[model samples]
Target: MIFFIILGAVFAAVFLLTLFFSMPAFQKNAPASSLGKLSFFDTKGKKHHPNPTFVERIVLPIFRKFLSIFRKFLPRNLVESVSKRLELAGIQDNVKVDVFLGIKFFMPFVFLLALFFISIFFKVPTTLKMILILLVPVSYIFPDYYLKSKTAKRQEGIRKSLPNALDLLTISVEAGLGFDMALYKVAENIKGTLGEEFKRVIKEMEIGLSRKEALRNLTKRTDVTDLNTFILSIIQADIFGISIGKVLRIQAGEMRIKRRQAAEEKGMKAPVKLVFPTILFLLPALMIIVVGPAILSIMDILKVMGQ
Candidate 1:
């Protein structure tokens, strides 16, 4: 009976969320068109939109109306923060801040409601009950955590890749290409978060942003220390009429040193990271395995003496 209730709650939630996700598909209640857009290209460069899916046609309009009731409660600053984080995570193209915020706002309550139903229908143990209570907050912030993790990983990749890109840029410049041409070369060859960033910078500059302004925007988007420092050096080099190749070479060396230092730091911390697991999990299990038979034999001898 408890299983049935929990399963029903899950299915109901999934059905509602499906409509909610498909809300992007509906026109004018237009997030509906997002998922159910059936957007496709006919050969010869033409596009077509199929009619909305049944869920979008029927349930999602009602679901959007239901979703709006909660949107009022997401504060302005919170929404702005979410938007900024989404951009940082590079997911702003795919996810609307409003939709993400709404999901974050409602998920915890939905979970608590389901758990409430389960508890009332079934006698949940105290330990499990406490764990469920703890998990509610985790469930609420999980999206935020995911975005943060993505942004951090992107920054780390940028940090590690900067030196190689700078070396390429420096080599290209030394090989007689202009700085802009060298940057294009690096973008052509480099791949990863840093390469993507270089591509964005090139596009920004092509679209009439001055080199200084575009590089500044690159720093704003990434916030990687070495990249920012390299940008700063380039900007100053431009201001003072220094050679960009020289700046690139210098920055490449410094970034390489920083990357090596970061690797060494991680190596230094590995033992510290391992210490807790070694003591708490491994030592206890090993001690029990090694001493168990001896202790059992001692207990048997003591029992025989008592007899």
Candidate 2:
């Protein structure tokens, strides 16, 4: 009776808290900022777009409130770290640290509540109980792991695409286009991570940021060693009044060589990586196929002799 009463009180408190937070008093009103006007109606007063999805209509509002609630609790250092990770992951603008933290804190509560219900309604094993406990930390740490994975993949894409982008920039610059024009051409020609980053750099330049600062920010956001070297070379060229074409050609050559070396290194490791699958999966399958028929034939002969 006491346990039920306590559980009911906890649920009531949670429900009340969720309601309070979801109210307008706790939520900030921010005007939408977009490049163009967002109109929901057409000329005939018809809808121009589909209705919002479940997440957009319901989850986001709740999440915004939760975000506001959790925003104040983050430590300064942790916020900085989250900001850096989000920048590297290419989701800095889309997902703020407070929103991410709110999700992180909320998931464990959800997991706990779900487990509590399962424990009440059914028999939960000791292993499941252990897993329920483990889910708490996993809920918190999963975001970091996900963010790191995204950053790694984005960096790899940027690294692989850099040489090609540099080559294009070199070609355009040598053909008499100015540095900025050549950068524009490269961004327009390539359709990958490198292209998108270059487009961002261009936008930054347009927004009154100096070229050197924009390039530095590009390197910082990418966190790729090859790109950092390329940007450093450009910055040096700018400082020394060296010919942009000459600097681009040199950087492109170095990037091509580095890319080739990376390819060769991966080629060398391929056979070593294949060895594990051969022993664990292929070798066993071959042995089973060869030995099985012979064992079956021997068993048949033994049965016939016994008959």
Candidate 3:
């Protein structure tokens, strides 16, 4: 009976997979949406479009399937909110909102199913069961939390790296490089979230986006205050007939000053941040070490007096 059941399961799984793959949608030339995303540029100044990988083919499809089932039940506002969050997280290219919602919708069932199987097989304690049950909600929330963290980190990276990148751009411009070439050089040299964003901007400019539009798009994508300030400054310089080098030079100095001030602010806040940990964990341990023996000795004396 076990052998037959295992064989039937395997056959059923294979049949489903085969049917899904054999569908004309999957067999036909991959959709433009699934292919040809802007990744980088080559020597000939052409945008390199990347093909979808394994995650897109397998994992995303599974989530997309779940999304389709529950699409009608989801609110339009909630979907738009999720889309904005994904865009901010800088994963708009790799993961669609539908696939993300599918994951969110499916995760609770996954957690409950795991718990069900574990309870069936193992002798589970009540506390553990409660924790596992709580985790179902957490699992549903984890993706959104992860995206928020990712967006925060990306913006922080841009903030930290902006000063140095600006300095390099200023130097390149001062040395007779055009703004586009200088920007491209800086993007190629400094690698990080900032560099990748600059590269994307450069690519955008190459593909018929005006410099202002490209810079504005960059500001939109990053949402970094300092970056937005720099973009606005550049745009204004273009409008008022200011030299690019002087603008770059001024922005570089300001960026460096702002970064220094930010560092000093964090340094000033460090003591305040440490105070809570010192009180909560270290102070109790220290009090036990210092006053514990004294309390013990006083107790002994009291016992002697009583005797």
> 96-197 in candidate 2: lDDT tens per residue?
566666656676776677567767876657786677678768866776776687678778888888899999999998899999988999988987667777
Scored by lDDT, the top model is: 3
Listing every candidate in turn, what is its Cα RMSD in Å to the true structure after a full C-alpha superposition?
A: 6.5, 7.4, 8.0
Candidate 3 to native Cα RMSD, angstroms? 8.0
Q: Order of candidates by lDDT, top first?
A: 3, 2, 1
TM-score-superior candidate, 2 or 3:
2
How many clashing residue pairs, candidate 3? 0
Q: Write the per-residue lDDT of candidate 3 for residues 13-75, one digit (tens) a residue.
A: 344344334433233222222223553333446544487666557855775676666776889
Global lDDT of each candidate: 0.71, 0.72, 0.73
Which residue runs does candidate 1 get wrong by more than 4 Å? 1-5, 12-74, 112-135, 285-307
- Tell me which of candidates 1 and 3 scores higher on lDDT: 3
How many residue pairs clash in all the candidates, one count each?
Answer: 12, 0, 0
CA displacement after TM-score superposition, residue 122 of candidate 1 (Å): 9.7
Query: Which ranges of candidate 3 are over 4 A from the true structure?
Result: 1-36, 39-62, 65-77, 109-133, 292-307
